[model samples]
Target: MSSLRAYRQIVRRPSRKIYVGPVAVGGDAPISVQTMTNTLTTDVDGTLDQIRRSAAAGADIVRVSCPDEDSTKALKDIVAGSPVPIVADIHFHYRRAIEAAEAGAACLRINPGNIGSEDRVREVIKAAKDYGCSMRIGVNAGSLERDLLEQYGEPCPDAMVESARRHMRILEDNDFTNFKISVKASDVFLAVAAYQALADACDYPLHLGITEAGGLRGGTVKSSVGLGMLLWSGIGDTIRVSLSADPVEEVRVGYEILKSLDLRHRGVRVVSCPSCARQGFDVVKTVATLEERLAHIEEPISLSVIGCIVNGPGEARETDVGLTGGGGGSHMVYLAGNQDHKIGTEAMVDHLVALVEKKAAVLAAERAAARAAADEPK
Candidate 1:
């Protein structure tokens, strides 16, 4: 079945794999979802609180900015408490990169070309090697190298790719291969073009994002359209959906993008139809309520909530649990694509929540049993 599923898959581009702590990126690994913390890094407790929330929301990696010595000083505690690996965002400061690596950061976000002299870059590489930390060469259009800006005359895709290559060359010169690269721009076209060019130019893992992509609504749409193109083409190894909203929302949106592509799965995915006048029950409110209630489920399962029987039965046949609204204030409930029972409007949301929770427990137990049997002696 898995092979049959792969037969219809989008063939991903081949790229070298690198590890950020225990999490792997590229080389056929599941595409990772990441989000940056907005809390001041020096506030260890506050930062850890946000990291915990993002991790709970399915962030594979969490980045915390290290703009000063104080932030680096607090990194040790944050790293110790964080459930997921931490990436220290360091720019223009070679010393902070070294400090962050020593403080147990899994990766350092830096551009070797912008962090002072060649000697400084080499020192940072040495620190990364010594402390078993990876690096991310982040090139942004808003902060292109002066020479590149002058040469290209603007923040174009060519300029962004050149900037990435320049930083990449510095890492290559130092023999540092444990790194990934991202070329981002606020403009969707520029960012997409830069990533496409970079993916063609190198075998290194490409991190995808459209930086500073507005607030919640705008950012989600922009990121979906841009990153969706890259992902469908098998370009991104990891992704960050940048937004001005809560960092957890970024994680959620990132997973949603991946889920839409069937690339990665976590939690309960609700397939709901836009409510219409043909509905039998309040489909909109039911979906909204069910989404919140099912957020705690980590197992990958599908639930379809349809307004009426027009497409409900077909969709229900493909999901683990489903609800299709019916006339006279009653609805149908499906278990494993088979009609198991009928539920009333008054008990709809609560009943679905109970059914899903029960289903999740069964799936989790089966997974655990399989793992246990696999570990038993032959």
Candidate 2:
């Protein structure tokens, strides 16, 4: 009922905008979510399958590794069939970078210096420009340039930023600016510090990540902490939660972080409580089930699944759909923030799923109508 305060807002950093296929990054664009495919690049069908699933999970961009000649050749089909833009990941292979560009990659994740020789760098850059592809200067703390490692004696924020600058200089020297940059480290502190320094040092869009972040659960927490701190400061332009899980989970986690920050919203935003002694239903299992069932609904909606009356009514007031557990093996359901009806536990999940589906359908029609209205001659 009240407007958000200034402190609740994220005033994003001003940086030059660039396009990865159709998605824009930086300079007033909605911060994008990216995930990398674990499938081998040469496995075209397998790679496309993963890309399709990741895109459905809300990945704005997907990167696939291109380690050799075979991978780049397979990239053409992968790019052609991909629903979202493809970023070809090239490390120490300028030829693969060029081939990826020629294969219709939307972006090349390549470091110019490591690709060997100024001429090779120029050729890769030429291919990128000629093929209408963008570039990403990816600097990972685990793989900082040898000279920088020697100079700094370790991987730290300074060394990371210096590596980014060195690569950034290569593109800048060639008068190329259609690119974004990332300085990632497995160490949260190092990654955050490096991103902070780089954010101040240049106006290039930053791709945030804690590289080599562990498995799903642990990696999610680690990335959330590091990325949350950076996003809270309005520093990152795009993010990838580098989890050692399905790339779809990475996209999901990326969106969750953005949703928590109020920077972006897609699909259901669940507000559930950890079960306690007074809970009326199985809160843990219910929330998990609801999340799995509602994953396909991309329309932004919020639902509150609380087990008892203590905080149930309060949370239900803020969400679109609310299920509050009550006695008599039945539960209370709230629609549009008002107490609406009751149903038995046997019918609860299905009933709530129907309510959300109906709500999402209505929301979709309203959006379509709004778009039609906007398109009409004024």
Candidate 3:
């Protein structure tokens, strides 16, 4: 049997906190969720639209690529319109990095090794300081520096860490200290191992990711496994779940990973069973529909929709609201664990949605009152 002790706790690693705009990362800050906009940076409206959607999905920070002069020029408008802090992604072009900072980017994503001469790096660092922007030293297994690749014969954990240190040294040598690092790879083992090694080797905030994982389903699973290992061991500070689908999906997946580990909670977490022959209703369809309907509820709550009485009541006992199917056309409803009432199959979806919305409103008001009370000059 799995150890019960594993469920009780996770002591996060201690690292210096840094601000990516107003959002705090590392130290005691809540682990933040991030996603990158795939829309062309020069298409300011399109990029801002995507950023808004990602933010609505609970993204704390968003990254936009600035590959040329036009993209950097557009950064001014995108940053101005974005609801969350924007990180300008620049590769091999120090001019774009400098321009992005002056354009009001909260952070700059650049691999120092790829940005050319030391003088250029110092200039970029100077720009970051002038604009009060933090930086992300992103080192990927697929894009390790040429010298490090030749040194290790391939992209391995050691090589990725070496690449990260090289970049860190560049910033430190230039007296730049406000930065986080990510050593990412699509290979789960490589990414996990590299992150673990990187976490141990530095006190700087670590940005966790499994780069270029895949599409929605495949990428979610791969990132969960890789990020799960690191998070369970108390390693990650901020996270981005790399997916090829909509940028919103990346933010959703990142929150789900954090939710599963009890590190953070944002929206409704549904605990439903995989329908079996003994199921009382269409378990799979019900869950799919409920997730879509409940997406608008931002407050964290748990709801279990079990098919039959086998494990239904037991699972429901642990959730805020629950439903367990019965032999008749109706099913039992659970509120705060105990059986509250029953409802026919036809009314199940609508009834559950109403109950969840009501519960969310009550919780939100309670939180507001608590905040108000705490603010009293006591």
Candidate 4:
């Protein structure tokens, strides 16, 4: 009886459109995926190379930390060489925000409260406007303002939302509307509740994230629970899965979240059944190997790996391509839901990967042909 029908009824809030370089972040635009760079921003070439890798991995926007003048100065080169839009992460330094804007960053992310006076915030805003860059006010529980902490006794959801409101009001008062907001907490519940409150308060697009979300496994779960709730409620505009691992992993997790929600499609989606007593062969290892090989493939395709013949065919029937384990060290290979042939278990992984590559080529060609036909006049 579980359904997505009622979830579809949630109305998305209206917000003004803003561009972070070439990617649109709000106002009916597709929810964007972002990741920050772990490379020292001062290493211009290394940073640019990582940015390219992130863009190639399906990241929509990239953020670089500008912790000092050296990194701030290197922003110009990084921005010039970056394949995707770049945002500068500034903390407790208004001048660095100004420097990053002038260096051609698409956006500047700063915590207004931590960056000092109202005048300093305005100075950063003025620089952002001058450079035609947007701003993101990132409010995290670990860094909430002292007064708000004293008033609320903790960095709770209400306190976080209040901090966001205060920063937002300052920017709005300066007539700066080209900005987004993020209120992040390590606690999943706190993060979700803070976003819900902000969604009800204003239409400024939200950059969803759970701050300090642990390593790959823990971070993925925390971010999914918090961001999934907000996205399901039509509350997030952009997302970053803050993992302690490589920044590229963050981009991958972001896309996976969007893919699960049916909001964005990128790379292949694999469906594999857990092996049971009825399983005929080693389905787990086969599926894992295939997944590793296809990690970088961006074309959207579905592949199912089932353990037993009983429910395998029926389940695989719905996928683009599939494999079902059988006896005698052999397996059934399915293409477009039809049993094509039987192959030995040792060769199954390679065969399926080759089949997928062949199918991907055909799909790519068909898409190109369609595009070429569309360009031709009647």
Candidate 5:
């Protein structure tokens, strides 16, 4: 146990623990993926539907903007119906934070600088403490305090770090330590630098993201670059890929980042070749179809869709399942690095999906058996 603890310490920063519903954040917990709903919070059914979708997409925590009375009032239904924990994003309104707490929010996201006065900040903290809810002091470059901007001329990395420290001080002064912090900037360099500075300055678990990261393609790349750097350096404890697209896409990107680092595995990882002149199949369309079909799958498996048989079998060795094209519209299937059989090109996708489903079922059963064995007698 001591050795295991030491290993964890070596891999991640040490920070106090906080719970958002049943999921743990900070020390020793697997880094979690989070996303915010774009739906109007007052639309309880719509918001709850988005929440359930985000949870199904493997979001460990979901946040909704609580900017008004209606949104706050709707929190009860959202929280009660959500599959995962909900965090209320309260800006400039301490009352909403209080209401969200009363309505069973698992966490409250508050920016102390914007929440009216010091007294208001304290009141929000008190509400959080009373309800046993965690808080996130989100410091965005777009909304840093004026004094810091005047002192630094812009929302530089230092200014962002200072802003986070200020909000953190407010929570600390109120003896409210059940909180995490995020210092986000639109610029990837600034966001990464600010997080690095904060990580050195304190032990609080860092919530990592590059805010307003454009649309699906642009935002995914931007977030992957920024969050990827922080996560690789062992700085982030929880992450949100702030894309201006469906919230579910954000959760998908978060897991991809974690999966790429071998830190966490929550879905199928499709590996395909870029296709060259020697290629034999329509690898592009096949890969797209496979990805679309496997988007919502939660099982962790590697599937390689190669274009030709020449280099395919060798590449397939690293994957759980694979397909390599044969001559004249035929294909060879490989399962767990072995040649399974041959099939027609038209039937390849369905065949691969069936093989994957079978493997996923067996994997699930093995996990259940192992868990049952562990819980039994010893």
Candidate 6:
């Protein structure tokens, strides 16, 4: 049997805390969720729309590529309009990094070593400092330094860590330390190993990800397995689930990964069983419909939807709201783990939605009152 203690608690790694805008990452701060925009940076409105939706979906930070002058020029507006902190993605251009900083970016995602001469590197670092921006040293296995590739003969964990250290040295040598690092790879094994090695190598915040992790479904699984291993080990601080799907999906999946480990809680968490022959209701369709209906809820809630009494009541007893298939076209509804009432199959979805919304309102009011009490001149 799996150890319940292991599932309930994780001893996170000790690391220096840093800020991506006002959002704290690493050390004792809550693990942050991040995603990147797929829209063109020049399309400020479109990018801001995506960013707004992502923030609404629970993205604490968002990255947008700055490949040219126009993107950096547009960065001014994007930064002004974004609901969450923006990290300018500067793959290789030192100038772009500087521009992004001046444009009010909260962070700049770049490898300092790749920014050319020490003087040029200092310029970008200076810009970051002047603009009150942090930085991210992103090292990908597919883009390892040629020298390291020749030295290690492959993109192994050691190679990736070495690459990170090289870039880290540039920042540290310049007396810059407000930064996090990521050693990502497309392969799960490679990404996990590199992250593990890097985690122990430095006290810098680790930005976890499986870079280029395929489509929505495939990427979610690959990232879950890869990120899950690291997060379970308490190695990640801020995370972005790289997916070829919509950026909002990335935020959603990132939250799901974090939610699975109980690292962070946001939105409704549905617990459903796969439909079996004994089922009296359409378990699959019901669960999906409820998920969409409850997507707007940001408050944490546990809901179970099982097809029959076999395991339904058992699961229902642990959730905030639950539904179990019953006889004569009526199904059981559980509220706060108690048998509340029954509903017909035709009206089940709407009824559950109403119950969840009401529960959410109650929780929100309770939270507000607590916050108000805490601020009562204590």
Candidate 2 vs 4: which has more lDDT: 2
lDDT, model 4: 0.88
Clashing pairs in 6: none
Q: How high a TM-score does candidate 6 get?
A: 0.98
Clashes of 1: 0
Give the top-scoring candidate (lDDT).
Answer: 6
* Residues 276-373 of candidate 2: C-alpha lDDT, one tens digit per residue: 98787888988899899999998999999999899999999999999888987788999888999998888888888999999999999999999999
Please report, in order, the local distance difference test score of every candidate based on alpha carbons.
0.94, 0.93, 0.94, 0.88, 0.89, 0.95
lDDT of 2: 0.93
Task: Give the Å shift of residue 14 in candidate 2.
Answer: 0.9
- Angstrom error of the Cα, residue 148, model 5: value is 0.4
Least accurate 10 contiguous residues by lDDT in model 2: 1-10
Q: What is the lDDT of residue 190 in candidate 5?
A: 90
How does model 1 fare in lDDT? 0.94
TM-score for each of the candidates: 0.97, 0.98, 0.97, 0.93, 0.95, 0.98
Candidate 6 clash total?
Answer: 0
Q: Tell me how far the alpha carbon of residue 344 in candidate 6 is from the true structure, in angstroms, after superposition.
A: 0.9
RMSD each, Å: 1.7, 1.2, 1.8, 2.4, 3.1, 1.5
lDDT of 5: 0.89
> Model 1: what TM-score?
0.97
Rank the candidate models, highest TM-score first: 6, 2, 3, 1, 5, 4
Model 1 misplacement above 4 A: 1-8
Model 5, residue 20: what's the lDDT?
88
